[model samples]
Structure formats: structure tokens, C-alpha cells
Target chain A: MLSKISFLSLMGPLRSVDIYQSLWLIIEGMVGILIVMLLIYLVVIWVNKIMNKIEMSIDKNR
Target chain B: MGSFSFITQALGEITLPMVIMWVIGILLIWLALAKDFEPALLLPMGFGAILVNIPHTGVLGDNGILQWLYHAGIEASEALPLLLFVGIGAMIDFGPLLSNPKMLFFGGAAQFGIFVTVLISVLLGFELKDALSIGVIGAADGPTAILVSQKLASNYKGAITVAAYSYMALVPIIQPFAIKLVTTEQERKIRMKYNPQGVSKTIKIIFPIAVTLIAGMIAPDSVGLVGMLMFGNLIRECGKLDSLSETAQGPLANIITIFLGITISFQMQARQFLSWGTVIAIFLGLFAFIFDTIGGVVVAKLMNIFLPEDKKINPMIGGAGISAFPMSARVIQKMALKEDCQNHIIMHAVGANVAGQIGSVVAGGIILSIAHGFGL
Candidate 1:
């Protein structure tokens, strides 16, 4: 009886992953990855431009 | 017969496995205290291991202080781990990562460990949600692991926390083997030179906000951790808030670590922690970390293929992509310097390290959302 109850509880949560759900998850993961990549690129570019401006300012002072 | 009975009475309570556990506990303590292998965490963990196995110690009993700390600090509201992040944020310098932003990619790639471990856990008979939560332990960041575990599988919180911390301290030992196995001697000795010019104060201050804004929108669940992390970095880079940053980096961080480490230890009592599941989980967590390193290094090597001539990256910094932060970065730099004393990969590695922190948090948030979506 104890084993039966435990088995029921475990099996109760089993959900079949259909095509739509799998697609949705894949799209979600891709979107997350894309956003991370874009943000990283923007930060690198912004930092580079700012550093260049600073270098120019320093050169003018010299 | 009476004298023999007394000896038998005393010896009857001691079990062989229990004795072995105690010896392991003592060895862990020795490693932490004598050998200084992450004494900050291992010492408390070791002492907790000893206390929990004291046969009749009430410290882990229903009304004991250790149990109370577990309830108050960990389970009740997840206070200690989140608060520890505030300290970690304060101590971190974002300048290196901010200057060479490309290192962020390495960080994201390193999180391959968390997912790989999740798949492995599933194979080990854990459900999808529980497996993902358990796998997050490999990200090498405790708070992120705790946050994900609480959200997904609070039942196994104690085991998960212990595994996360133990594996993180083992990085120095674990990573060298992984690094040596993957890379040829010639690759380990490969040198690349690029120095990021000094970053302006304005850009440095703005970088964290931009990251928070970008990452927050993408992975909303991670906002609290990622936001505060960037906020701490913002204060550090802002230059005017020097004193505030110093306080966050020092006393505030140390005090919080004290609370976090001890509170985490409270959950390590033998009754809850000595199961076969716990042992398997530790090794599996290490597997996640190893795969994360492999994923990062491989991607880095792949990236080198597309780089414009003269800009090829040395792949060693890929190991820094794990969320161990300065520790991972320092290890990568040490390895690099061994090959060439003048080589400096710290900046690039720091960038990857910080990126890994953000990536791990985002991954945690995603896992939380997925679990929530499934109503798990």
C-alpha cells in the first residue's frame, strides 16, 4: 500500500511534451541567448567608444 | 560477564559507517584549517559535519540552535544567500570585465555545466525540475543555486547547498585536471596580447546599469540578484562612492559570509545529509562544472576560427567562464603566467568571470520560470 501511494504520486506529475511545447521552449531559449549576445556586444562597443574619447581628451591635454 | 557487558554496551552504539563519516569530517576540517583550502567556508562546513555526527548531539534536534538557524536563515525566507550576494557584489571590481566586454560570451557558455548536469540528473531518476535545480549547483555560485533550488525543489535544499559549496571549493583541484586533459601543452603555452585602455568613469558607471537593464528584461526572475550585483559594481566604478564601496567590499561582505557559511552548515547534519543521493549529487555537480569548462573552452576555440587575422584569442580564459568569479579568473591567470610570466589574462578572465555570474543568474531565472510554467 505504501509503495502504491508513492508510485501514484511520482507518476502523477508526468506530462507528455508535445510538439508545440517543445517549440515554445526552444524559442524561449533562443530568445534568451540572443538578448544576452546583443547586450554583450553593445557593452563592448560602448566601452570602446568611451575609451577612445578619453584617449582623445588626454591627447589634447598633452 | 558484568565487565564484558559494559564494554559491549559502549561499543554497540558505534557503527562502522558512522565512524568512517566522522573520519571524513575530521579530514575535511584538517584540509580547511591546516591546508587552507577555502578555510572561509570549509571550516564551518567541517565543524558542522563533526557536530552532526556526535551520536547524541541535540544541536540538530528539533529545537536545537543549528536547526533553528537552518529554518531562520535558509528555509524560512531564503535570506542568507541573497544577502551574501550584496557582500559579493561589493567586493567585486567590474572594471576588467566592463573594459573587455567580449569576455561575457565565455561566461554564458560556461553555464553549459548547469544544463548538462540537469540532463544527467534526469538520467539518474530525478524528475526534470529537481534535476535542473540540483544541476544548478555546478554553476559554482551558491546564491544562484540556492535561489533556483528554493524555487524548484525546496525538499532537497540541504543536500543541494552542501553540494554547491563543496564543489566550488574543489575548483582548484578539479579544474587543473579538466584543463590539462582538454588542452595540449602547446595550447596551454599559447600567448595572446591585448590590453584594454583605461575605461572612463562615466562608461564604467553606466556599464552595470546597461547590463541590469538588458539582462533584467530578458530574464526577469534574476532581477534581484543581477540588479544588486550590478548596483554594487556601479558603486565601485562610480569613483565618488569609494567609501561606500569599501564598506561593502570589507566588513559588510565578511559579516554576511560569516552568517551565510554557518547558516548553510546548519543544514549539513548527518541525518539529512549522509544519504547515497547526496554523495552521487556531489560528483554529478562536479561533472556539471567540468562540462561547463569544456563548453566554454570549446566555444572560445571555435570563436578563434572566425576572428580577423591578428585578433585570435588564447583559449585558456575559457575556464574563467565559470561563476567562481575572481577565483576562476585567478586560476586561469595563474595557469597563463606559468607559461609566460609576462602574460596577463586577468582582464579578459575577469570579464568572463563577471559574465558567468550574470549568465548563471539568468540560467537560474530561466529554470525557475520553466518549473513555474510546468506548475512543478
Candidate 2:
């Protein structure tokens, strides 16, 4: 984040809180979406596996 | 003599912008009717634009009906968009996405346009909040755009709504055009095998609940939007609430949509609508949309570098990862067919398209959370 600030110091968000805040928001938004989506993906995969196991055991009992 | 004077006074109240707004209103109506550009919303919005823009328009006056709807439906608690989201959530089927969870990556990737647009808007001298509103146009979901703009108290709410819905209708032309700029003919022709595993009813029911929890905890601000959307989806997947799901997806949704369209016109008053900010918002909205398309495509292309030949994805599906839903999914499917007759990637595209829906909602929540965090 500091790197982004200094790098953009010459041409970007340093002039106002709007730009600076937007800069941070953009970085966080992108990464935040990735993290959330990835977690959901993992959850889906885990659920599928767990569900499959439960069904398999049910079939074995039958 | 008094009646004649009253007529003259009314005529004298007409400004050039008011007449211009009437014409703009007509144009929106034409686009909705003649061109079939989101007729469900645009037709009412267009007519209401004229209704609100008329000189001494009653709708803009104290206690006007439109004003009441706007205040109650939108301003007070954002009930309209959130209610519409319940309908939207019920309408969506997450089976395709759950069977192929990796499509969630495309959903996340496709949001690139939003952040890019904000950076551009701020660079071009717009306020952060306004820029945030305009950037959400990339979300490609009108409800999320409206909700975010309302939350941020953006000045360009009307323009953002217009761009969000308009570009959503233009997905066929815009997605293809943007897809072409970054992808090759070969990439567009990449055929993905779609063998969807059976998605159990249990997983289907859990999916929305889990999404609500994940998104709400992280963004906290997204709780209302995600919660309502997931609630609708839960109604659909629960199997016991068939009647409730139908209501949410049908009459309830249709009714809210009608009011939501017309009520949005409250912001279209000529004095407010006619501005440099609106024009810039239109352009920025397009930029956000295009970048979103390109962003998804680029990520797919990057992913291709790591995957084996047989596992390569149709990069066009990446473009479908905006929240346009079945429209985005359908457009990519048609484009894929145009490139090769035998390639059928609709299922994959559908997965990504639905992922895009959740993606856009989460993105909106993320924006609100960040804004509140910064005291913006």
C-alpha cells in the first residue's frame, strides 16, 4: 500500500483524500473479492466431498 | 383573466434544459420500446423523466407521488433495490456454479473494470463517492449500482442507473467488441467440455446461506443486500417453500421492478440530470463495463498458461462474468457458436454468469464497507 502511495505520489491520489481513498478502496476491493470468492469455492468443494461421503455411507448401510 | 395569467406563468417556467430533458426522456423511451433496451425499466424511467422534468412538475414538488415513492422506496431505507434483489436471488439457480466452482475466479476477475473506472473517475476530477458510484456500473447489475449510489449519496445517481441498465442491454454488442480487443480468434474458439455433476438439493440450499455468511462477515456492510438475495435463493432451494419461491420470483419481483424503474426518475429532474458529471458518468460506465469484460478475459488467458491443453477454458466465458446473468451467458454461447458450430460452453458460461451475480453484490458491499471505514 505504501509502495502504491509513493509510486503514485508524482501523478496520483496524494493531492486529495478522494483519490487516495479510492486507490486504497480499489486495491482492497479487488483482493477482497478474490479472497471471498476463493473461500466460497473451497466451501463448495468441501461440501461436495463431505456430502459425497455421507451419501456413500448411507448407501453402504442400505 | 387570472386563468390566462396562470397559463402564461406556467409557459414561462419552461427552461431550455426542461425541454431537453423531455427529449432525452423520449429518447430513453425509444430505446426501450423501439430498440428493446431493458424495456421493463427504461420505458417507465423514460416517461417518468418527462414527468419529473416538466416545468413546475408536480412530481418534484412537495408531497408529489413520485417524490413519495422515491423517499419511501429509495431514500428512506433502499427498500426497492433490496426487495428487487430478493426476486433476483430467487430467479437465479446456483447449480451450474456449484458444480463448477472455479468459475468464481472469473467472477472476481471480471470486477477489474469497477476499480479501474474508479481510478479513472477520480483521475478525471470526480469525487471519490461519485466515482465509486460510477465505477459500480461495471457490476452490470442495476440493483447493486442503484444501492451503491444511494448509499454513497452520489450526485450522478440518475446517470449511473442509466448507464448500468443501458450497458446491460448492450452486453451483446459491448461484450463481443470488448472481447475482441483482448482475445484472439483462437481463444474465442476454445471449446470447454461441460459435464456438470449432479448438484444435490442440500448443497444448493447451503450455497446461498454460506455465501451470505462469507460476504456479510467480510464486508459487514453487504449484510442487507447479500442477506436478502440469499434469503430469496434459500426459498427456491429449500423445496418446501415452492409457493414462496414462485411468489418471490414472479409477482413480487415484477411489482417491485415496475416501481423501481419509475421511482428512479425522481433523480432525473432537468436541473440535476443535465450536467457535465452525467456525461462523464456515461463514458466512465462504459469504461468500467469494457474493463470488466477484458479483465475476466485476461485472467482466463493467464489461467490458460498454467492449464493443460485439454483443460483450457473458452476465454469468452470470462467476459460473461459480469452480473448480466443469462444475457451475458447467452451472448457468450452465441458468440462461441459463431466461432465454431460444435462448441457448447453455455453451462460453463452460465456458471460464470451466476458467479458474476454474487461477485457484483459482494463488490458493492465491499465499496460500502470501505467508504464507511474511511468516513467517506
Candidate 3:
């Protein structure tokens, strides 16, 4: 009985990789990475823009 | 009579396994010296293996020098790899990453291979813990592989470390094969504009701290690994500690690396290393790297669909997302130059490459926490 339960548990994660499930997991992971990448992209752009703005204001004051 | 007896005893103690291990060790030494493949580590490892396997050497026994070093660095508490991380952290210049943080995504994307490999290993009848350790070879960071395997699959630690470091050294060869399979000449020639800008000093110092805090909060298990790495980076960026930074990157790193390499060979006794499982672990490690390359390239290709005409990445830069560091990034740049001499993607690739360093550690931590949660 314990062996049977253990076998079932082992099969649990495997089911998610049967065929379509594998594709979904790949897509999900890819999307998560993409989201993180996009966020980093946006933050960098925003920060650069703000820095440029501050530089321009300082130049104007001079 | 006593001297003759000692010689005879030594000769009599030689076994088939010891001979085989000695041969393997010699081969490792040849590869290190002749081929110049990770000589600093492999040479010491090979010599240590040879020394330990000699009959009646007692080099790997409880009070042996090798045993003492292994316990002090590896067995005692995982101090060796963490110390090496500080050196690695000191050497890394996050300016490129800061300039183009979008490359950070490729780091995350490349880690997909780790999970995919784990799933495959589990399906192939490996225990979940063992599979996780084998899969982490995809992290492409030698220390992370060592840390994970030591904790989860101590028995296979030698094989796992060998696989991880060997593949890392072969990044220049492996990455190109994978990149060519997925990318076209036109995509490879896609030249990214280089715009070098000076980042403020304050940002450089803050970057390591912020990353450590964020990563720690999200994956608490990774704090030790990430924290030590960030601490090294902090020493580098602090500006007032140039001498300390140099020490961390130079002597400190080299010394730890030598110790770590030699100590690891203590586990490479032939009886333990020569097995079907070792072969499988090696092949799985290669597959992990291949998948990591695929993951990076595929994600880059996917992103190109949404990006505008001018903003489309070369797609090959995605291959740089594995934690082989500057080597992977350099391979991408060389391929781009081969495609078109005018093309320059080194900076972008470096950004992605550095991001991979952090991504790999975080991924290792996440895997550790998940394995713990599973009660494995």
C-alpha cells in the first residue's frame, strides 16, 4: 500500500508533462521570464529618462 | 627486511579499481595541460585523484591532508563555494547589466532548462532528489551545482561537479551548435546599436544590496549563496576598498578554487564514479546546457515578434543567458562578427550573460526550497 501511494505520488508531476502539459509549463516559464525581463527593461528606461530630465533641468538652471 | 615488507605491502594493495581511477586521473591531467581546458581546477583534481588512489597512501583517510581540506571547506559547512562566490562577485561588473537590464530576462528564461531537465530525469526513474541535483547542472554555475549536489545527492557529488564544470568549460563549443540549430544568418546578423553611458556610482553600490535583499526575500534559502556573492560585489563597488576587492578577485578566489577542486576529487574513487548513473548524469548535464541555450534563443525569438523592426534582438544573444559568464557572451559576439563584421552585440550579450550569473543562483535556491517542501 505504501509502495502504491509512493508510485502514485511519483506519477503526479509526470502527468503535467505528458504532451500538452509540457508545452504549457514551458510557455508559463517562458512568459514568467519575459515578464521579468520586460519589467527590468521598463524600469531601466524610466530611470534613464528621469536621469536625463534631471540633467536637463540642471543645465537649464546654469 | 622492514623496508622490503613496506614495498611489498604497497605493491600488494594495488587493486583494479585503483588502477582504473589512476588512469582516469591521468586522462584528466592530460586534458587539463594539453587541451588547456580549465587547467587550474582539473590539473589539481587529477593530481589529487592520482595521489589518493596510490596504494597505502592514506591521503583520503580520516586524518589525511586531503580529508582535512575537504572537511574544512566542503564538509564542514559549504564555506568553499561561498568564498569563491565572493571572488566571482568582485570580478563581475554589473554596469553592462544595469545599462540594459532587459537582458536580465534571458537569464530567467535560460533557467527553464533546469526544470525541464529535472522533469526528464525524474521520468527516467531517478529519485526526485537525485534528479534535482542532476538537473541543476543546467544552472551552468559550478558552485551552485556543487552546493546542490552536496546537499541533495552527496553520493553523486563528484560526477555532478565534473559534469557541471566540464560543460561550463565547453560553453564556447556547445553554445554555437545549439545557436546555429535555432538561428538563421539574417537573425544572427541583427546588429544591436552600442551606446556606452556612464552610470552613477551610487547606483553601482546600491545594485548588489538591492539584488541580495530582493532575492533573499523571495527565496530565503538562497540568501547565503546570494548574500556572499553580493557581499563580494559590495566590496568591489564600495570604491574605498580597491585593495580588498583586488584580493577577493585574485588570491582569495584562486586559493579557494584550488582547494575546492582538489577536495572534490576525494569523492571520485573508481568504485563510486564508474557507473551507469555517472554516464547518465553526464549526458543529462549536456542536455541541460543544450536546453538552456534553446530556452534563451526561443524566448528571444518570441520577444522579437512583439518588438518593433529596429528593436528586434539578434536572437543569438539569448544563448548568452546561461551562467557560463563572459565565455557565453563572447561566443555570441564572435558568431555575430562571423555573420557580419559590422555587427556588434557584445555589450548586450554581456548584459544577458551577467544576468545569468544571478539567475542561476536564484534558480538553485528555488529548487532547494521546492525540494525541501517536497520533503525529499
Candidate 4:
């Protein structure tokens, strides 16, 4: 039972071996690149909000 | 039996291979000193190579200083490059990236070459792990390449490190050619406007910490590399540790760089360093860089299709996405100015260039994790 459970858990990580492992790696690489792009996009949006707020505060003071 | 016989014996040991290695070492030194190419690293590496290759020196043999340095710093643990990241982090200012966040996508896009090279290398008959190490040279990041090669392909570490640093130094020459090949004359002339905005000190302090936590959580194996780098940036941003930041960026960085360069030469012994595999690895490294340039430009061109006219990015700035940092950025700027004398794209190029730095590290971490998962 324990071995079966472990095997099931391994499925997601093991997805990197679907076809030839190298080909899987290429797919994994693309996914990783996309994740980084998403993170950057989110961070940029958040920073823009903060900067806009700060600009507004500075304008009020002036 | 005589002293004369001892001199003759020493001369006899100098084979054609040793002579060839010596000549290569001399050329490296010449490139560093005369051609002004990456002198900080190549000079030490070149001198170390000559020192080790001299007959009977045994500098790369058991109990030798170079061997000890290699074992202590590089072979024993992956500490040197990770520690060097701290200094690198301290030197970086994330302001440009923050001001122009869209440039971060270029960083992600630029990593296209790393994956492409992995597939090509496998097709060429390299094992998956070895191919991954070779592919990482596309990251355009010397430390990350060294880290990956040391972990995954220790056999080819010397060739990969030399190729990584050599190509990094050659970015000024290589990137322009790659850029010219893919880009139109009109695309190169597109001017990007730089809006100077002030990023608050509080956000600057928060940025490194946030990146460290987020990147570490996403890729656990990358914690050491990304964490140390963010720590260095934190020291610079915190405003309370100016002296520490200075030391981290200056003396600490210099000492590690010198040790790292000379120690790497221990692997450059003629027997292992001079091989068909090494030659292929060097050429593949160049191919990876070319692919990275294409990836960045293609992504930018793709994005242009959706955006309004004035806000569109200059596609040439896409080439700056490689992790050569300011050098790649400067090349794009120079090319742009040459095409249209009034155009200034340095700020936008720098934003993408810095993003490439972080993007490369993240990609390296992801690759490391995937390689580990396969138990390679």
C-alpha cells in the first residue's frame, strides 16, 4: 500500500519523463519559462500600483 | 645521473600537447591584456594554465596548490559560485527593471536557447545530463553555467566554464551579428522613450526579499543561489549596511573571482581539455546564444502585433535579454544609435538585461530541479 501511494505521488514530478526524457525536459523548460514570465507580469502590475499611489501622495503634498 | 641529465629529462617531458596548451594559454593572456577581453578572469586563468603546464610543475597533480584550490572551492562543494552571487546581487540595482516591468518577459524569452540547445545536444548523441550542462551556456551567465556543469557534468566542467566566460566576453561581438542577421534596418531604428520615475527606498528593500521568498518557494533547489544573491541586494538596499555592501561588491567579489578563475585552470590539462567533445561543446555554446537572440526578438515581434503603435518595443532590444547584463544592453543601444543617430534605447535595454539576470538564475534552478528529479 505504501509503495503504491509513493508511486502515485511520483506521477506529477515524473511527468517530466512522458516521451523521451529529453523531450520532456524541453516541455518542462517551456513551462518553467512561462512561470517566470507570469511572475514578472504580476510583479510589474503590483509595482505600478504602488508607484502610482506614491505619485498621488507626492502630488497632494505639493 | 648528472644535473645536465635532469635538465634534458625535463625538456623531454614537454610533449606536443603541452606545447599546444602553452600556446593556447599565451593567446588567452594576449586576448585579456591586449584585446581588453575579460582581463580579470582570463589573465589569471591564462597564467595558471602556463604555470601548471610547465614540465614537472605538478601544480595540477595531487597535493598541488591549484588542485587544492579546485577541490576546496569548486570540487568539494558548489559554494564559490553561490557566494559570488552575493557580490553580484550587491552590485545590481533593480530600479530600471521596476520602472519598466514589461522588459522582464524578454528575460524569460531569452532563455529559449538553453532549452533548444539541450534538444540539439541530445540529438547529437550527448546524454541528457551532459546536454543540460552544455545548454546552460545559453543562459549567458558564467556562475550559473559553472554551478550547473559542476553538479551535472563534472567531466566537461572545464570546457563549459571556458566556453561560458569566453562567450560572455564576446557578447559585444556576437550579439551584434546575431541581431543584424534577424532584425530589419527599420526595426533597429525604433527609438524607446525613457521615463525617469523614482522608486521608493522601502520598495527597493522589499524587492530583494520578495524575490528571494517567491523564487525560493517556487524552486526549492534554487534557494541557495537566489537567496544568497538577494541577501547581497538586501545589504545594499537596507541602507544600514553600506560598508558591508561595499565589501561584498568590491574586495569579496575580487578575491572570489581570482580564486575561481585560477582554480578552473586545474581542469584545463591538455589530455581532458583538448578533445572533439570540447570542440563540439564550444560551438554548441555559440549556437545557444544565437538561438537566445532569436527567441527574444521573435517574442518582441509577436508582442508588437497586439500593442498600439507608439508603445511598441524596438525589436532589437530583445537581444538584450541574454544574461550578459550591461554588455548586451550596451550593444543594443550602440546598434540602435548607429541606425538612427537620435534613438536612445539604453534604459529599456537595461531593464530587459537585468531581467535576464534573474531569469537566467531561475531557469538554472528549474533545470537543476528537473535533473535532480530524474536522479541524474
Candidate 5:
């Protein structure tokens, strides 16, 4: 797709025609980070909820 | 083997490039001692450069201590860097990040530079593997750079390590400039209040493990990298292994660091590191950092557009999303304070900084995942 941009000439052996794969890597890599980080966030929230509840029960017993 | 002939052979082996490498080595040493630029790593790497470049040095040939260290520590299985990750994980306090869990998004956003640099490197004619290695210099974490490049077998490993560590040292200098490029004075002055949240001990204990499982499941290639890091953190938070955690955080980490720098320099033989590719790798490394800052800042700004005014994040916090850790977080705080003395954003920035730590490793894993996807 990049090859059609007449103004975007590449200097390497991997021409614009070869860049579609690279573009995909870039796209998925960023999205993947966002997804993974978000998942981690959810885990923290989930873990906190459970732990906080247990701690509250222990305090009531005390 | 005669004494007279040995002198002649040794003299003949001396070349201008070797001298040039010595100068470069000296420059690194000077930076370490005089400028305090990553003294722990640069000092030894600089000394190693001088040692390896000596003609017919036993360090490069059979029975070479340096060569043995390189093969055993790095090339054999990435043991040293991974071990170092445990120490790094132990040294981290995830309290800030766990409290401000939302900062994790900034971590993902800050890795924008790595991907951008990969495309740019490919555009400039680097083979995809070399381009990926070069781009990872933006990870802003040294061990991640080394492990990624080594695993990928990038020909530019030495240059990538040098670039990664050097740029990390220059974070204070590089980040402010990059943050300035995308933000105005008004935006820089954007104030965010700091509210300390009580992070439960159990949550702290579970965080690293949860991060590993979550990150590992998505990118199995990241298990080693992510798992080791989280393992180190577990020791720190487990509450029962204080001494073990201290050892991991102190002595073990120190000894490994001492080995890591000089061992990595094995690849910095004058013949390997003096190429045009090294120079290009260095420049591309800078761009990765710049682009990372842009990515994080832009995302934060975009988020501001959708949020209420009182809830707007000081976009500078996004720049701290690189894995440069406390340094990046500290820089953001310094910048915030400069804008307004009462503006204390250290907690928020620390949250993002630590998240960057995870973000960078995950980004490295993503690169590995992409590499695997291509069947490389």
C-alpha cells in the first residue's frame, strides 16, 4: 500500500511493498501493549477488591 | 614466538581503528566519571573497550575470560540480564503503580517509539530483525534491550546496548526536550492533585504474579522476561524474604551488573562497533526515545479532550511512561514543580514511571511475539 505513495520512496532492499508486514507489527504491537496493560489494571482492581474485603472482615472480627 | 619477532607482530597488529576505539572507550570512561553518566555500566564498558581492542588480546581468542563471560552470561541463555531483571524487579516499589492503576495505559502508550523506530529502520534499509533490535533501544530499559537484541541475534548488539544505556542516562536531557516539542506552557502548567491511596499488602503481593500471568498468557515469548521481573518483585513484596530480597536487590544485582557491562562489551570489538550501522543505530535509538515521548503525551492529551477539566492529567505525566523509572518520574515532577511550586505530581508520575517499566518489558515481548509470528 505504501508503494502507491509516489512521494514515499524507500532506500532499502525492503521496499514500500514489503512494509505492509512491518506496518502490521507496529499496529498490533501498540494495541497489544494497551490490551495487556489494561488487563494488568483489571487484575489489580480485582485483587484489591478481594483483599480489601478480607481485610475488612478481619478487622470486624478483631 | 621469539621475543624480537613477537614485538614486531604486536606492533603490526596495532591499527588506527584500534586507537579510535580506545578514544571512544576513554570518552565513555570520562562520561561515567566526570559527567556521572551511568557510572556503574559505562565505566567498565569503557575499560573493556580498551582491553578488547589490544591486538592479539587473550580476551577475544580461546581461553579469553571476556569471551567466556560473554558466552556464558549472555549468549548461552541471557542469564545475566534476566537475573538482573530479578534485581530490578526487587528494587521496585509497585505501591505507586498499584494505587494508580490507570497509569498502566500510559505505559502502553509510551512504547510508541519502539514501533515507530522499527518502521523507520525498515524504511532506512535495515533487515527486519536488525530494525527490531534497533527499535527496542527505545525500551528505556537496558536489560530489556540486551536480552531482546541478543535473542534476536542482532548484528548490532553492542551498538544497541551502548545506545540504550547512554540514552537512558540522558533521560533528564532527552525527555524534557521531547515533552516540550508536543506540549505548550499552558499544558505544562496543568495541575493534577496528589491523593495517596492505601494499597493493601495483599494487593502488592499479588500484583507481580498477576502481571506475569496476564502478560505471559498473551505473549508467551514474554514469560521469561516478564516472569523474572515479577519474580524479583514478589521477593520484595512477599514480606518473608527480606534478606533474600535485599540480596537480590543489592549484592546479586551488583555483581551481575558488574559482569553485564564488561561482558556486553565483548561485542564492542573495534571491528564490530565501528561500522556505519552502529552510527545509524545510535541515531535511531534517539528517535525511538523521542517518538516514545510523543506517543505517551499525545495519548494523554487525547484523553484530556474527553475528560472533565478537574480531572485532566498533566500531560507531562505521560512522558514519564518510559521505563527509565524513577528518573523519568522524577523528571516529570521536577518539570511540574518548575511550572508551579505547589504542583506536586510525583505520585502520579511514579505510577506512570513504574508502569513504563512493565510497559517496556511488555513492548520487548511484543517485538519477540511479532518476530515469532513471522516464524523468525
Candidate 6:
């Protein structure tokens, strides 16, 4: 963690926050999107699978 | 004696890295010619690979021939990929996706790889910008990856480019495992009917233009990629411009593809590209690609619940959501065939494939904007 902080400091500050702060924000944002997107996608796929099973049963009965 | 000694000294300047580059160069030629993965790209890439590897060839020596071509064709203007897009656009048919627009989600879902790769890259100690640039490999869109790499100025250009194309070639192998892992045998057998007749020619023509305008408005950063891609499609779908479209889809595309492939390989020499970072980048890239498949398929299945009785889609096409183009779509078709041979899901798969192409560019643009916003 100390080395990571020093590495960020060496990169110099171009944005509003310090380099370490900015790197943290960027990583946080990316992870947020990745997790949220995966959750949404998985939920959708599971729901679809359940519905398909019900639909198949109905069609067979008809 | 002095003159002879000077000449020998000049010969000694050739580096061992350059020798290794020569071997890799020959391998690319063999892969292109004998294996025939993508002959158009591999051949020129192989040739360029050889040219650049020669110790004192002066091609990339200082300001030599290959460098001139690289600068003029690729690096200077970034014209080749965009120009090639016109041909690709002209060659595509949007009828399938138009008939079933829900597959658009698949395209959007497949882009999960890029973001996932970025996260893993950061974990492995890569900087945010470089990781983002490298993650575009999972996008499965070569031009998009190049566009982002050039914009970000990531130091790992050669490895990034190879990772993008190599994963593309490996699609046939990678996608099946992904599809099967996420989907059960019962889910694989799910059938849905799609008819191309539902899509009118007017709609086909309008689809590309409308998507370009809407997508551009949403993500202005993607104008170059989305605009060029749509422009190609416009030429393809338009009733007129047969000659223009033909040129775009034919020699123009073939020539550009050759240059693009070779130039990428030229960047892949062992000296510049062989590093621990290279290994990490490839591993992270494969992670992105696999996740994208999961994301897309899962999204498609989720969308199925909202549909009325007859409208449920085969979830297999979800895997086709990545921007691997026709290859991902073909994989979907094969998976469906395995379950039920007569099930013709190619149309649905293609719809998702093309949509994935657009979705990837949009995601690439969004990443660029995010990076820019953070002032990185």
C-alpha cells in the first residue's frame, strides 16, 4: 500500500485530487459498474429460465 | 584493417531480441498461410513481421519503410480501421436484428468483459489508463481497441493488439465452453421462431442511420467508430450505391485487413512485447471475454421473463452478445443445432452479433468519457 501510494505520487497530480485519490475513484467506479451489471444480467437470465419452463409446460398441456 | 573492423562492429549491433522477432515473424506467416485462420490479415502481418525483425533493415530501423507505412497508414491518421469499417458496414445485413430487437441487450451484455478486465488489471498493479486500454481486447472489436489504445497512449500496444485478435480467432473454442457452462441442456433446447420477412427494406435502411444518430447523441466520444460502422452499413442497406458498397466490402476491406493484421503482428515482437505485463494482459483479457459471454447470455435470459408467451428467445444467443461479429453468432447457431438440428437460430444469433458490435463501441466510448471526466 505504501509503495502504491508512492507510485501514484510519482505520476504527478494533473486532476483535482491527488494521484492516489483519483486512482481510487477510478477503480471504485469500474468495480461498481462491473458488479451492478453482472447482478442485473444474472437476474434477468434466471427469470427467463423459470418463465421458459412454465411456458413449455403450458404448451405441452395445450 | 580499420575498415573491416568497422564493418564487423556494425554487424554486431544486431540484437538478440531482433533474432527472436524473426522467428515469431515466420510463425505468423505459417499461421496465416497454412492454418488459414484469417489469411487476409495474417499474410501481410507475417510479411511486415519479417520486415521489422531484420537487424539493420532500416524498415523500422530509424525512420525506415515499415515505420513510414505504420505512421502513414495506421498511427498518423488512424484511417485504415475506419476505412475498413465502410467495407464491413457494406457487407452486413441487419434484417435479423430488426425482426428481433431484444437481442440488442446481448450486445450490451457482452461488453462486460472490458470492464471486468479493467478491474483485474488494476488488481495486478496496472495503472487505470493502461488497464482500460488493455481491457478493450475483450470487446472483440479490433478497431475499437486500437482507437482506445491510441487515445490513452498505453505502453502495451503490441500485446494489447495481439490479445484482441488472438481471442477473436480462438472464439470457436472459447464460446462453447462459456455457453455450455452457463446454460443447461434443457435451456439449450429452448426454441423460438424468427422470420426475416417481418423486417421491411425501409426499416433496414433506417436502422443503421437511426442507430448512428441515437448512439452518437448518447455517447459523442464514439462518433468516429459508430459513425464509420454505420456508414458502412448504410452503404450496405441502401438500395443504391451497389458499386460503392461493393468496393467497400471487397478489395478495399481485404487490403486494409492485410495491413491491419501485419501491423499488429509487427508490434508483437518478443523484445518489445514479451514481459510479465504481457502475460498478465493476456490472462486478464481472457477473463474479460469469458465474462462478457456470461453477461450477455444472462441478460438475454432475463429479458425473456417480460415477454408474452410466444416471444421467449432461446437463451443460447445470449453468448453471442460479445462483439466477436459473425463468429460468436455462428457459435450460437452450432449450440442450438446440437440440441435440435432443425432449429435455425442463425438469424437471431446474427442479430445479437451485430448489436454486440455496436454495443462494444458505445461501451468503449463510455470508458473514454469516464477516463476523460476523471481527468486521467
**Residue by residue across B1-376, what tens digits does model 1's lDDT show?**
2455754653577665557557767776787788776677667766776666665567767887777877887678767777667667767766677667788788877877776676666556566666777878877888888767876754456677667777787777777777887787667766766667566677767777887787777777777777777777777777788898888778877776666666666655655666767677777888988988887888788887898646777787888888886788888888888887877877788888887887777777766666677687
iRMS (Å) per candidate: 4.4, 4.3, 4.9, 8.6, 2.2, 8.5
DockQ of each: 0.20, 0.45, 0.24, 0.20, 0.65, 0.05
The sequence of per-residue lDDT tens digits that candidate 5 reaches over residues A1-62 is: 56654233333466655477789888999989988998998888888888878989999999
Q: Mind giving the per-residue lDDT tens digits that candidate 5 earns over B1-376? A: 4568876887798998899989989999999999898999999899999999999998887699999999999999999999999999999998988888889999889999999999899888888889999999999999999999999999899999999999999999999999999999999999987766579888888888889988988888888899999999999999999999999999999999999999988988988999888899899999999999999999999999999999999999999999997899999999989988988899999999999999999999989998988776
Tens digits of lDDT, candidate 6, B180-272 = 878878778888887553555666676666666655665577677778888988887887988888888898898888777766654665566
Q: Could you tell which candidate, 3 or 4, scores higher by DockQ?
A: 3
Model 4: CAPRI class: incorrect
The model with the greatest DockQ is: 5
How many angstroms is residue B329 displaced in model 4 relative to the true structure, after the best TM-score fit? Answer: 0.8
Question: Which stretches in model 5 have alpha-carbon errors above 4 Å?
Answer: A1-11, B1-3
DockQ-derived CAPRI band for the predicted complex in model 2: acceptable
On residues B152-205, what C-alpha lDDT tens digit does candidate 3 reach at each position?
754678888888888888998999999999988888989788775567676688
Candidate 5 backbone collisions, by pair: none
Better of 1 and 5 by lDDT: 5
Clashing pairs in 1: none
- How many collisions between residues are there in candidate 1? 0
For the candidates in turn, chain A alone yields TM-scores of 0.69, 0.61, 0.68, 0.60, 0.70, 0.71
Q: RMSD of each candidate?
A: 5.5, 2.8, 3.6, 5.6, 2.0, 8.0
Order of models, best TM-score first: 5, 2, 4, 3, 1, 6
What is the C-alpha local distance difference test score of candidate 4?
A: 0.83
lDDT tens digits by residue: candidate 2, B80-159 = 99999999999999989999999999998999999999888877777778888999999999999999999999999999
Query: Model 3 chain B — which ten-residue stretch has the worst lDDT?
Result: B1-10
Question: Alpha carbon lDDT of residue B118, candidate 4?
Answer: 84
The lDDT for every candidate, in the order shown, is 0.72, 0.91, 0.82, 0.83, 0.91, 0.72
Q: Positional deviation of B123 in candidate 6, in angstroms?
A: 1.0
lDDT of 4 at B263: 83
